[model samples]
Target: MSLSGTRTHLVQTARLNTFVREAGDPSAPVLVLVHGNVSSSVFFDALIEELSDTYRMIAPDYRGYGGSERKTIDATRGMADFSDDVVALLDALEITEPVDLLGWSAGGNIVLQVAIDHPGRVRKLILEAGGSPYGFGGTHGQDGTPTAADFAGTGGGTANPDFCARLAAGDRGEEATSPLTTLRAVYVKQGFTFDPEVEQRYLDGMLATSVGDDIYPGDSVPSDNWPGSGPGTTGTNNGLSPKYLNQRAFADLDPAPPVLWIRGEDDVIVSDTSLFDLAQLGKLGAIPDYPGEDVAPTQPMVSQLRAVLEAAGEVTEIVYADCGHSPHLEHPERFVADVRAFVQ
Candidate 1:
């Protein structure tokens, strides 16, 4: 659905049909927003509306999410598939000039891949509670060392089955494991609540996730590691595995684009002790078969990101207190001010 000053439509790129939400004047400087996993471009609706006067905002729902064509994500390619899709969309729109890019969560990794592969395409880069350069889970340290040779405990298999089931069933109830509850508990910090209408919109976006073996959680392989499973070669979760998605090369760029890294101080999802990390869970006794800290430790996501950005060159880091994984949602006024300062 279109929001005030915004329009939703489908754009057929060379790779697939993509759903796009756009706002602001066509002649304005372009600012592309890429949403994270389990969510579509709809998450950016408020931001688009907030900044419509200054930017030609473009938010596209990548494959396997929102109204985009459902396609199996090739985990072996890392984030190349998604990054290429973004570039293809830009090409389809005849946007030849470099544009400002903002990526949230998984979308952050995709944008980094884009900058690494096609540096000239991005005028500046913004990562909001982005994933580690080394991928999401099954890794440790600021360097992102794999926990196992097979990269166990970090793939489609790691996904909570009940959560996926609920997602597939489109369960909109307030059950503990339901999408709404997860969004409420995990998406943001504790005690934070969305406006009722906005909450429903975001919930609808979350439910749009395509579910299948080659989709949402993807597939996995047997392993002798502590988790007893490894990343499979298909689906979104596997595609995000450290085994496949590693953008360490981003630091090697001769002259990387300026970057603005914004994250919440209390972000549980991407924090060093991320609750989602099986290793962290194991340490906290939430998962059985503790492998000890030496064998498995919480991934130092923020430090790793800082290291890469520092090495890459010009970088600005902003941490918001009393916030969670989504600074944009929690502090829209501040978020917009930061963006305006950085991009202007």
Candidate 2:
């Protein structure tokens, strides 16, 4: 089943034409990798190379991101579309049995949705720096109480406009918010670096992201909340807002799968005081009108996930020291070893 070659193909699923990178023997156990926001399956290339021998590897670009078709993402579904798309991919591939699923960041949200909605299809779940069970923002406590009914402090408007513009323009410069700079600084541990050629490939996948109100950062709504912004009725990040997203139902799965929650100790993107979250920014005076913790405290993302998973049973937590948002990229060998052991 071991193989060194990588192959790319367009899987014609009922939902959208998915672009997949696969390797290893077809007869082997399946390992599907789902990537995060502003990123494609390209980030998993190194991990695939390291684990290809042990299991069949399949990494598919989600509909709006990479080589996949630029289909519209309906934010109201609360990641149901992404979850359904993955199941459709498995169906198209004729993968009847349960498969090991691994998701990173936003993809972590997708995998949890799949496990909750289609429990039979997932044998095990790996959440790497996944979004909070309460969703991305506008929450107060571990219970994920909305800071505002509109879920203000979250959604599409929060995305850095200059960054989105640069991505749309395919700017390769190293200035702040540039795709390359983000890939290095925010995505991984600050000093960790990827091979120059591979970095270029991943950057191409990142820039391939469809920039609009219906995708990537998504849309927004004005709110009475401190930040004065809230989740819109449409878009990806909005879909993830507490108003639309919550996977606490995962604890109710009849035959809950074993879960591996792996995260980087230094991951600023998904931390308790996430830089991307407006609530944290507001507390730090990064945003105007400093709100006290009672109004908008740092969303306890890890605590929320733990509370749900621990209730479900058989959850293992691993925090990688010195790692950032992407453990697979910042520490590939360790990530590969841990995942291989988990799946095996």
Candidate 3:
């Protein structure tokens, strides 16, 4: 939102012109940050601001989320399509080689898919509480486990307190309409648990950003295909399915690209999983343990990740004690420091 940064346009998925941010020097190594669903590139504002001085960074809002226009009903774009958007954006920027990739939560899943689908394009993989259909370390489940719904109403029910703080800080950047309005919408529409102040700040900051009469452009999304079961499916499969039922979007990975698991112990959504046995530090039935035994990896969360990489002969994992689902957001200094150490 700050006009001081360089802005560039890239065409992706249906020739839709997408906006992206470029910070630091082109000569420096590149870093791409992908955000999660129902959120925009703005989510990475703090991280970007911190990293801009050292590494060249790019963060683009997926269609239907931020400044980008929604996809028309006649068109559609899925996870693969979104990953392709990343590739297209990179190609447009002439990033012919792999760059450090950081995907937070759902964005982490997207980044993993990108690395899996197109190896050699990624130098290092960093997944922040990233969920995968194939389940990494089997710590998460195939269906994300039912416990996730419990968090639905937690954390202010999607009430972004950070966005509120930014607003109070006099940041007129691209903010949601209002913290209160968003909080009300969350309770009414999504059943979230958020504070009114968040909504108030959202409204205040939103007024600062120029928005149309309609703030959300759901009607403009390219794809509305439903899975007919679980989460937001339509049960019809719509020639496509949700993560719970679809693989066309994320392919079955084979010894997938070396992975780095970065998670926060405090994140309820990403850290607290019913499937995980914190005592065992692995899933009950999904992870590999002994050679040819398919035993669960007995390593600690980070150590297990490291063991997985060591077994693969090339991967890295770093865990922050005080971090949550998004260490980059929760512990920016340490997160960026660790990432720079690995990437450089």
Output the worst ten-in-a-row residue range by lDDT, candidate 3.
Answer: 232-241
Note the Cα lDDT for every prediction shown: 0.92, 0.87, 0.49
What's each prediction's TM-score? 0.99, 0.97, 0.59
Top model number, TM-score: 1
Report how far off residue 21 is in candidate 3 (Å).
Answer: 1.7
How well does candidate 3 score on lDDT at residue 238? 13
Q: How many angstroms is residue 16 displaced in model 3 relative to the true structure, after the best TM-score fit? A: 2.2
TM-score of 2: 0.97
Q: Tens-digit lDDT track for model 3 on 244-267?
A: 312223233454555567776554
- Candidate 2 per-residue C-alpha lDDT over 72-106 given as tens digits, one digit per residue, 9 for 90 to 100: 78888898889999999999999999999999999
Candidate 3, residue 101: how far the Cα is off, in Å? 1.0
lDDT per residue for candidate 1 within 216-328, as digits (tens), equals 98999999988788999998888889999888899999889999999999998888888888888999998899889888777888888898999999999999999999999
Please estimate how well model 3 matches the true structure, expressed as its whole-model Cα lDDT.
0.49
Q: Identify the candidate with maximal lDDT.
A: 1
